[model samples]
Structure formats: structure tokens, C-alpha cells
Target chain A: MVEKTPILDTLTYVFLVLGILIVGFPIIYALIAASLPIEDVSKVPMPLIPGDYLLANFTTAWTKGNLGTQLINSFIMASGITIGKISVSLIGAFSIVYFDYRLRKIAFISVFCTLMLPVEVRILPTYEMAANLLGPIQSLVNVMHLNWLIDWFANYDIDISLNLSLLDTYPGLILPLVASATCTFLFRQFFLTIPEELCEAAKMDGASAMTFFRKILLPLSKTNIAALVVIEFVYGWNQYLWPLLITTNPKMMTAVIGLQNIIPQADDLPFWNVAMAGSLIVMLPPVLVVLLMQRWFVKGLVDPEK
Target chain B: MIKRSIFSNPYLPYLLILPQILVTLTFFYWPAFDGLINSMLVSDPFGNYSRFVWFKNFIALFTDFLYLKSIGITLMFSLATAITSMSLGLLIATLANRALKGKAIIRTMLIWPYAVAPAISGILWLFLLHPSYGVVALAIKKFLGVDWNPVLHGGDAMVMVIMASAWKEISYNFVFFIAGMQAIPKSLIEAAAMDGASPFRRFWNITLPLLSPTLFFLMVMNIIYSFFETFGVIHTMTQGGPGGSTNILVYKVYQDGFIGLNLGSSSAQSVVLMSIIIVVTILQFKYVEKKVQYTG
Candidate 1:
């Protein structure tokens, strides 16, 4: 931009146009394909132009793919993750930034440590734990030879065994995924920028920590909360491996995974049109969020301090 | 950094952090610890017999040709995906940064791909490249006279997954690259331009060096992206098929543990992956710390 020579200016536009073409080609093709008739979709060289079957393909996809349930599941999961992660992270960040506590350093380190252990790295164990939330405790009791203690208590008509499973449930889908430190770190970084005088003023007013957080800090965090919501919502909606691992029930499957179900079976004709429509449906929500909240999304993604 | 004026409530602080700590411990530490323990314990496929054999599973993993092959494949895939995506991202970002018109519209158009899930992106590419009726596949066969079936060809499958992964990641790298480009002081560029340096020379001499930190950060992020995040892409695309061509480490762990029921090997693989992530994360943090010092 300092000295944009005419030739260089033309070259820039040329490359950008080419880049956009290549980048946009797949989605454009999918749109065109999705609009085509079922038979046209399977043509050796599928029709390039849009057709009249857009609604028909979408209808078939929605009905056959069980997309209604899947979309609802995805919405719940994405919203749950955004809300749960933000609230937990907000409080955790508040504790770290605004309070002096004995275990603060340990808590910070533990949360930071989770950054390295993404769900993929601990998939099997996480699945097993989700299958039985109390498995670790049960194992510990067995390891500690506390069966006799339980038996003794049982003899006195007391039972101490505990069992819970999170699989195929919304909490299961949301909670494990929420146990990351990105949002906490982001909030902590943002909190560090706030003036110390605000806390002093709140303290002078004899406001409780909770009240200050509610009345002052929460109001200040609106932009940050919105940014993180955009990022986390997209993240939650796009999750595939975790949901695929835990949600065995069709009714519980998220839209991204459920898109697979809409694909015609191996024996059936490959109705690429219907599948393309389903792909569009599954992609719409997160795409819309990103487009609508472009500023916050970019800030959440690129802000180094976060 | 603690605030100068702060709240001092021991119980409330603990209560505030308790949810985060509890969720982390149960979901992260518990599973990670279980993975470490399970890595040492060999169990039959049916889970009827089990015994702790310290480091045996890891030793077997290193010795096994298939596992070693998988490691090689994963490294290759990660590098290919990262480099392809980063280069394409840089190209677009550089162009977009220079263009004098419609900057916002161009950015909006290009960045929507970032929102497309890897699996959905894979499906989109699949429709384009599917063997029987895929438009591009047919064109390649017709014009190039080359069979383009990912289903049957290992090389083709690898290319397919890489294309899909790179396509999805370009928007992320593009966003970062644009930010990096904008952060480079315009005065520096203008001074270079005034000094009779060619556009290419100025960019190569100044812009590239200044952009190295962002480049390095994006490199690590992209490698991590291809390693773990592309599970959906590989799963939906080829399922690591055509004779185990695309079986990246993450997908292999899923396959071995859930499908093959090799708990010991799977757990060992998970430990290896965790260690890989930790090392990469440490490397990133170290570089980031150095960058902070340099900038400060």
C-alpha cells in the first residue's frame, strides 16, 4: 500500500480474485449441487447451474436425516457449552484476578495444565469416565480396600455405593468439553486491564465481592463475553469426534455427525443433492454467527493476550 | 498478576474456583491419569484378563511397523496440511492487505470457511471428489485421463484429506496473517519504498521478518490443528482407508480403542499424543515469551 504500482495493483486483484475463486468453489459447487434434481445430482459431470429442486432436496434431507432433532441437539449443546464455559470461567477468572487465596497458584496451574490435554488425547478414558462418572472413585475405593468398610456399613443398613453415567446426555456433551482454560485465560487477561481504583471504590462502598462482580465487572465484560460466546458456540457446534464417541443414540447426535446419516446408504443411490442440502443446514448456524459477529470472532481468535 | 486493590475472601475464592477445578479434575486429570495407568496395563479384547506390564505397550508401539508407519504418515499429513494452508492464507492475506477496495467484503467472503466444520467441509469435498459421480473426479478422468478414485488409491485419498483440511484452515491462518500484516508499521514500509527498494524486496526484507512470530505461532497451531482437529475430516472422508493411508494418530487411537478394542495400545498411543501436545505447547509458550520480551 505504500507505493502501489499499477502492475502490482493489477497483480494483487488478480491473485485475490483467484484466491477467492478457489476458496469459494467448494461451497458454490455444493450450493449448485444441492439445488439440482436428484438424478442430475448423480450425473458424471453434475449440473453447474442452480436448479428448481432446492426446497425439495432440503425437505428430503430434513425429513430423512432426522435433521430437526439433530439441529436442536446441536443448539442445546452449543448454547450449554457457551453459557457453562463463560460462567465457570468468569468466576474462576474473578477468583484469580480479584482475590487473594492460599490455593490460587495451584488452581491456576491446574487450569493451565488442561490446555495440553484436549479431548482427542484422552478420548478412550474420557469416554469410559463419561460412561461411569464415579468410576474413578469406585476404583479408588477398591484400591484402598474399602469394600469391607462398605460391607460393614451395609450390615448396619447403610449403603455407600454410588454410580452415575453421563453418556448420551446433554451434560455429558457440554461439561467435558467445557473443562478447558482458554476462556478463563481470556477473562483473566481482560480483567488485568481493568483499573485497580474500581475495586477500591467498590470496597469503600462496602460492596461484597459477588456484588461488585455482578454490578460492575459483569457489565464491563459484555464485549468479551460476546466475543467468547461467538468462538465457543462455533467450537461446540462443530464438535464431531467427541459427540460421535459419546452419543450413540440417534436422538442425541449433533447436526455435524448427523449429516452423515443423511447420506444415502451404500446400497442406495448416492443422493448427493440431499446430502449437500443437509450439509448447508448443518453449516448455517455457526456460519451465521461468524458473519453476524465478525468483529468479536476475529478479536477472540487473534488477540494474543487471550 | 493480582490486582493492587483486591477482594480477600478465602471461602468465596475457593467457591468461585471450585466448579472450574472440579470439572477440570474429573474430565481432564482423571482421564489423563487413567490413560497413563491404562497404558501400563494390558487387557484382552474382551476385558476378561488384565495385567500391568510397565512400558511394554510403548515398547511394542515403537517396534511395530504399522505404528511407526502411522507416525510417519501423521507427520507428513501435519506438515502438508500446515504448509498448504499457511501459504494459501499468506497469499490471500497479503493480497487483501494491499487491495484498495472492498477490503471488508473480501474478508467476509473468505472468512466464512472458518465456520464450516471439518466434517462438513470434508463432505463438501467428498461430493466434489467422490469416485462415481463426483464432478471434479469425472473431469480429471475425462481431461487428464487419470483415474481419481480416493476410495481405491492411497495417494489420492491423502491428497483429498489434505485439500479438505487445508481448505478449512486457510481462513484461520488468513485472519492471523492479516492481523500480523496490519501490525507491521506503515512508516517502515513507506521508508523502504522511498529508499528505492522493489515491492518484492521490501516485503522479503522487512515484512517477512516482522511476520515471523505470527508465522511461527500459526505453524504450531496448524500442526496441532491437523493432528487432533482433523479427526472429523479424516473420519468423514476416507476413514483412514485405502490400506491405512490417512490413519493419523488421533484417528488411529479412536479406531484401535473403540473399534479394535486394543485398550493397552490405545492408551499408550494416547500418552504419546499427550506428550506430543505438551511439548508443542511448551515450545509455543517459550517462543511467545521471547516475543513478548522483544516487543516490550
Candidate 2:
């Protein structure tokens, strides 16, 4: 806020350069290393500049590691999760904020509690859900003996059995994240700011509640929707622990999981260049999202309550 | 704050709310409930045929040496990450907050790394610090003549993880700190300067006090981040290696629950993490409540 002295100006530049160096060095180094052949990477005093085998390394990582398929899988999972989260949380926000509902406060409070209870804490049972896929629903059907009733329907020449699974699928990857507590909170906050007169005007026009929401609230919520989409998409793309735990098939693996899968976990040394190439690829989408839609990303993160 | 006006829809509101509620109940509440039950019900070493045993898992955790050490290491790691990242963030933020050339460029350069996933960041750092093939590690070896292997040394592993965690977090803290500082009224800063306050004096007197709210907010967020979100980092980098030196509470919960197959103990650890999160969340609400009261 004060007038900067020459010393301070130099210090500021120094700090900027230092910050950039500290932050960007590893990423750049990895990108550089990713380009080189394995022999070049293994040698002491590794090259700091770009290597000549960039295309070859990329192609190798793609063909051998199945990086292309993993990227597609990750895209599907991320977009699926993002859509699921936005839709569920948006309707939730719409319901609680615009409509008068009994136990609304209870619903809100429970959502808040869910914010505190991250999936990491409930990994064991959540893993159970992922493993069994439809265990909860199947058990419900069995407990209530809906199968006997299904047998009763079988007399009408319709067969129904209640066995299902979501293991190694997009729905499995996306379903558990549909209950996005943070997005709900952000949406609720956004909806509260919307002037009540919109709804009043809709009512004056004899608009039904659904129409009122569709025409009024939904349109007004474009910013919140965009912001939450970016945030949730990054979250979905960056999901490591859940997808890592659930997905066993290579065909089902996402890019992030694939990156780690390529890395060495035990005594043997790994293919460093290939691993680095995979990491660089894994980092692309989220970095691009934040860089491209930076305004919404920043606003969504820093000033959500505003 | 209740909405002043709302639609009256008895049926449609419930219909709208049902999807989110059902998802929340199934994924969040049901699993949490299962974890609660599993915590109290002790299972065999092989995790089969568990009978109800209240609080024993928690008791065993307290009595266990490694679990206690994990608590200490987690505290140290969280505090280290938060403080390191936040201080560096504050420093760089202050530097960039000045009327410097290429201000937008500097910020754009600094902020993009926040989008890098924690695990990816860990992998990058691991590549840099790897024993035999790492470029930086080789440079450090030649310059300082110290053997560098995080895979074998606990202290080195902790440092590596803290560095990786702090690296990703610095951009986040930088954003908030810059935003917090920018929100301060320039008139106050100028007034302090006009009153013959030096830049350092003005910063300590006015800017820092004004930034305390943001500081406190980031403190809570960073701590929670280190607890829950650093799973990817630990998983990729150390995997609680070098004899459980870098194992934080969250990772330990995973290590025990998923890898060790001690369902009761892992569930107990989850319950402990639950209480910890509850405390942090309450602290956040308390701060928000105080801010509300202050504003009112």
C-alpha cells in the first residue's frame, strides 16, 4: 500500500522469480524428463532442457501404458461425477432455498455434517459399497422379500431379479460423489441472495413451482452452476483414493490412477521417463480447466460466500 | 438467515430434494453408520466373525505405540505444512501485492499449480528426490555431499512430503492472502504511511491485523487439508514408509483399514478422525458466528 522503494522493488522481483522457480521447477523438470529416453534420464546431471524424444515418449506412454484409454475413462468419470453432483446438489439447493419444506433445517444441518465427514473417514464401508455395488439395495429387496412379489408378477410373464453391480463402471465412479455437500452449501448461499420478487412475479403469472424454478431460479443460477461445475470437475478428475481403491481392471482405470500404477511401489526401479510422461498427462486437464476458466475458478474458490 | 419469500410447494419440493437426500443417506450416512458399528464390533485378526465390543478398538489405539506416534507425526506434519505454506504465501503475496511490473503475469504463473492434483504433485517431487535417478538429488549430493534417500530415512521422507504438500498448498494460500490483503482499505495503509509509519511498521500494525481473519480461516482449511486431502500425497510418495515415520492419521486409517485388514481398528481410527473433523468444523462455525456478531 505504501510507495515502493528500489530495494523493495528488487526484492519483489526476486520473490516472484523464487516463487516461480520453486513452484514450476519440478513440473518443468518432470516434463523435460518425460521427453527424454530412459537411458538419458538415468544418467547423472540430467538434461534441464527439452529432450528430442518428446513425441516418441508420448507415443510409448500412450501405446504401452494405455494412457489414451485411461484419459478417456477419466474424462467419462469426471464429467459423469460432475453432472451427477451438480444436478443433485442444484435440485437440493433449489428445494431448500426456494421452497418451503418441512425438515428443511434438518436437511441442511445433515448436509453440513456430511461436509465434515469426508469419504476418507468412511473408506471401509464405502469400499464395501463399491465392492458389492448394489449390496445395499439387494439386501433391502431381500429383507422386504420383494422377490416373492416379483414371483407374483412372474405369473404375468415378466421376470425380475434383484442382483446388480457397479464395480469398474462410470456409474460406480460417479455415484458416491453425487452427494456434494460443499456444492449444496455454495448453491444454498447463492439462492439466498436471489431476490424473492422473482418468485412473486412467477406466482402472479400463475406459474407453477416447477415452472418458477425452471424459468427463474435456474437461469439466475448460471454463475453458481458454472463455478460449481469447474470446482466439482477438478475434484472429480483429481479423485485418486476412491478410484484407486475401487477400480481393479486396467480398462476401468482413470488417468490419475494410471499414473500411480505406472510408478514403482516396491524395490524395483521404475521407468522414470514413462512415469513422468504419464504424470504430465494426468496434470493436463485440471491445470487447463483452472487456467482457462480462471475467473470462475478463483471466484468459486475465494469468494463463494460473496 | 431464513429466506424472506419462498415458493409453497408441498409435493414438488420433496421431489426436488429427494435425489440429494437419498444420495447423501446412502453414501454419506449409511457408510458412516456402518463405520460406527464396525468400530465397536471387534473382529478377529483375519477380520471375520466380529462380536460387539464397545470402545476396545479405541482403547487399543491409545495403548498402541505406533498409533500414538502417528498422532504426533500428523500434528507435526499438519502444523509444518500450514505454517510453511502460509508464510511463503504471505511473503509472495506481499511482494506481488505491491505495484510491481508484470503483476498479472506473476500471479498467473503462481496460481496455476493449485490445479495440480496432490498425488501428481507428490509424484513430481518424488521424481526430483528419487535416490539414484533424480536430477535434483544428484545435484544436492554433489554440492552438499549428503546421502539423499527418502525411501530409507524417516526424517528425509517427512521433509519430502512436507515440501510436496506445501508446494501445492502455497498457491492456494497465496490466492487467499492476496485477496485478503487487497480487501483492506488502501486509505488506512496510506494514512499509516502519512503518519510516518515505515512499510514494515505499517504492515505489522495495520495489514496483518486486517488479514487475521483470512489467516485464521486458512489455518483451519490448511489443517483440514493436511488431514484429509494429503492422502494422495502420502499414498504416492511415502505410503507411510520408512517405518511409519511419515504416516499421518488419515493415511494410517487407510493403511490399517484397507491394507492391514484390521476392520475394527480402522473403523475406530475413522471414528477418531470423525471427532477431529467435528472439532475443526465446529471451530470454523464458531469463527463465522463471531464474525457475524461482529458485523452486526
Candidate 3:
């Protein structure tokens, strides 16, 4: 900005325009392709302008691609992960920042260690664990040769080997995705910034920890909660690998996964129009979230202070 | 990090933290520990029996040609994606910082790509580059006379996945770069300008060095992104296909474990990836600590 010459200003505009075009081209192209008729979609050099079959393509994508059910599933998954992560993180952060427990440091370290193990790295075991919620315990029992102990307890008709699987379920889709170290750290950082006087004043009133947390801390965390909700919702909605692996039933798939189903096989004639429409349908929610909640989204992303 | 005036009720704090601790222990620790154990165990064809062969799986991976090739492919992919995304991000951020008008509009237009899921971005690119009917593919064939078939060509497939991955990531890098640029002191630039320094000279001398911390942070983040987060792109776009040309390590782990049913090899791959991530993360944290010290 300092001593900006005319040529430099012109070059700056040129580069910015080029950047926008490169960034926006795919979405714009998808928008145009989604509006095309079925026949024109496969034509070489697909049309650049919008077409009249927009509603028809959307209808085909909706019914044939099964996007309606999938969108609902995505909504449930996204909202579930958002609310669950925020609640647990708030309480987790509160405990770490407000209490003097002996195991506080250990708990923090354990939670922080989760950052090193992404879902992709441990896919098989995670799938196994989700197949049986008590799998680790079962493995421990087996490894320790505790089968005889279970058998001895079976004399009273006790079923010690309980099977609880979370597969093909909402909790399975949502819960594994909810253990976020970043959100807990974010809340911890925010809690550290709250003045000591507030806690002291609340203590002078002889208020319980829960009362102080509920009455003051929760209200104070509105902005942070809003920002985190935007980030987590987008994260949840955009999830692919976990949801794709967890949900075997087509009826339970997320919208993003549903887009794959609608794409014709490599051997089959590609239906570019319907596929693009499906892509648009899949991307709509998170894109809208980013655009509408732009402020909170930017804050959650770029601002470490949040 | 605790408050001076703190809650002393021990039971309530435990109750409060129980959900997160339980989830982390069950989901993260259990799975990670299971992967470590599984890496050492080889099972029969049927799910009948297994025996421990410690370090054998890792040795096999090192000796296997396909696994070695995959490691090379992963490094290349991560490096290419990180460089392409970060350079473009820096360029755009610098330009945007200089522009005086419509800055908000330019930003909104650019950052929406951050919201586009990697799988969806892959699908969009697939539409543009499908060999038979893609508009851009056809245009390239016409203008450049190059036979562009990603389905059959390994090199083309790599280019496609890299572009798709980088396309989705540029916005993230751009956001960080913009923040980094904004954080630079204006007086420094103004003083350079008053000394009759060219904009290029000032940028190269002062701005770039000052932005090194942000650049380093983005480099680590982008490497991690290309490593782990591009799973969806590779899955939907190439499926590690055309004779496994586009197979990154994360995708290979899934394919080998879930599809090939090679549990030991896949778990070993997972362990390898975990180490990679840990190293990169530690590097980033070190840089962050240094940055904090410089600022604080």
C-alpha cells in the first residue's frame, strides 16, 4: 500500500482477478453443469451457460441419488458432533482450568495425545472398536485368560460377555468424531483469559462450582461457542472417510457419500448433469454455513486467541 | 493453567471431565494401541488364528517394492501439494494486501473453497478432466495435442489428485498468509518506501523474512493436510488406481486393511504414518513456541 504506483495497482488487480477466477471456476462450472439437460451433459465442450433443466436435474439427483435421506443423515451427524464436542469440551476445559485434581495433568496429556492418532491411521482398529463398544475389555479378558471367570459366573445365568455394537448407528457416526483435542485446548485458552476477580466474587457469594459455571462461565462463552460450532459443523459435514466406512446401509449414508453412488461406473455412460447436481446438493450446507457465518468461521480458523 | 481461585470439590470435577476422558480413552487410545498390537500379529486366511511376529511386518514393508514405491509416492504428493498451495496462497495474499478496494469481496470469493469438501472437490475436477467428455480435457487435447487420459495414465492421475487436493487447500493457506501479512508492521514498509526502495526489494528483504514463521507453520499444516486429509480426494477420484499410481499412504492403509484384508501390513503402515505425523507436529509446536517467545 505504501507508494503504490499505477502499474503496480493494475498488476495487483490482475493477479487478484486471476486468483478469484481460479478459485471460483470449479464451483461456477459445477453450478452451470448442474443446470444442464441430461443430453447436453455428455457433449464435448459442455455448455458454459445455465440451462432450463435445473429443476429436473435436481429432482433426478434427489430421488435417484437418494440425497434427501443422506442430507438428513449429514445434518444429524454434523449437529450431533458439534453439540457433543462442544459440551464435552466445555466441561473438560472447565475441569482442567478450574480444579486442582491429582490426575489433572495426566488427563490433559491423555486427551492431548489423541491429536497424534488421526482416524485414518487407526481405521481398522477403530472399525473393530465401533463394531463392539466393549471390544477392548473383551480383548483384555481374553488375553488375561478370564474366560473361566465368565464361565463360573454363568452358573447364575449371568451374561458377562455383553455385546454392544455401534455400527450402522448415529452414535457410532457421531461419537468417534467428537473427541477433539483442539476444541478442548481452545476452551482452555479462553478460560485462562477470564479475570481471577470473577471467580473470587462468585466464591464470596458462596456459590457452588456448577452454579458459577452455569450462571457466569457459560454465558461468557457465547462467542467462543458460536465460533466453535461453525468450525465443528463444517468439519462434521465435510467428513468422508469415517462416514463412508461406518455406514454400510445406503439409506444411512451421508450426502457426500451419496454423490459417489450416483456417479455411473467407469464402464457406464457418465451422467455429468445429475452428478454435478448431486455434488451441488452435497456441498450446499457447509458452503452456506461458511458464507453465512463468515465472521465466526474466520475467527475460529485464523484467530488463535479464540 | 488453573485459576487461582479454583473449585475444590473433587468429585464434581471428575464428573465434569469424565465424558472427554472416557471418549478419548475408548476411541483414540484403544484404537491406537490396537493398531500397535495388530502390527506385530499375522493372521491366517480365515479369521481362525494369529501369531505374533514382532518386526516382521515392518521388515516386510521395507523390503516390499510396492510399499517402498508408495512411500516415495506419498512424499512426492505431499511435497507437490504443499508447494503449489502455499506459493499460490502467498501470491494471492500479497496481492490482496496491496489492493485498496473490494478487499472484502475478494476474500469472500476466495475463502469459500475452504468449505468445499475434498471429496466434492475431487468430483468437480473429475467432471472437468474426464477423458471422454470433460471440457477441460478436450480443450487440452485440442490446444496442446497431448493425449490426456487420467484413467489410463499414472502421471496424469497424480496431477489430477494433486490439483484437486491443492485446490481445496489454497484457501486455508491464503487465510493464514493474509493474517501473517497483516501482522507485519506498516512502518517498516513505509520506511523502506521512503528510502526509495522498490516494492519488490522491500517485500523480498523485509516482508518475506518476517513471514517466515507463518510460512513454516503453513508448511507443516499443509504437509499434514496432504498426508492425512486428502484421503477423500484420492478415494473418490482415483481410488489409488491406474496400477496404484495415486496411492498415498493413508489410502493404502485403508485398502490393505479393509479391502485386501492384510491386517498386519496395514497396521504397520498406520504405525508408520503415526510416526510421521508425530514428527511433523512436534516440529510445528517447536516453531510455535519460538514464535510465542519472540512475541511475548
Best by DockQ: 1
After the best TM-score superposition of candidate 1, give how far the Cα of residue B83 lies from its true spot, in angstroms. 0.5
Best by lDDT: 1
True contacts kept of 2: 0.71
Interface RMSD values, listed in order for every candidate: 1.0, 1.6, 1.1
Q: Ten-residue segment with the worst summed lDDT in candidate 2 chain A? A: A155-164
Q: On a 0 to 1 TM-score scale, where does candidate 1 land against the true structure? A: 0.97
User: How much lDDT does each candidate structure score?
Assistant: 0.91, 0.83, 0.88
lDDT of 1 by residue, B121-201 (tens): 999998888888787788778998988889889989998999999999999999999998898899988999899999889
- The sequence of per-residue lDDT tens digits that candidate 3 reaches over residues A129-174 is 9999988788777777677676676654344474799889999999
**Per-residue alpha-carbon lDDT of candidate 2 for residues A207-236, written as tens digits (9 for 90 to 100):** 987887788878888877777778778888
Error of 3 at B79 (Å): 0.9
lDDT of 2 by residue, B99-192 (tens): 4578778888888888888999899889888887777778778998978889898988998899899999999999899888888888988988
lDDT of 3 at A161: 74
- In model 3, state the lDDT of residue A59: 94
**Cα distance off (Å), candidate 2, residue B70:** 1.2
- DockQ comparisons of all candidates to the true complex: 0.84, 0.66, 0.80
**Sort order, TM-score high to low:** 1, 3, 2
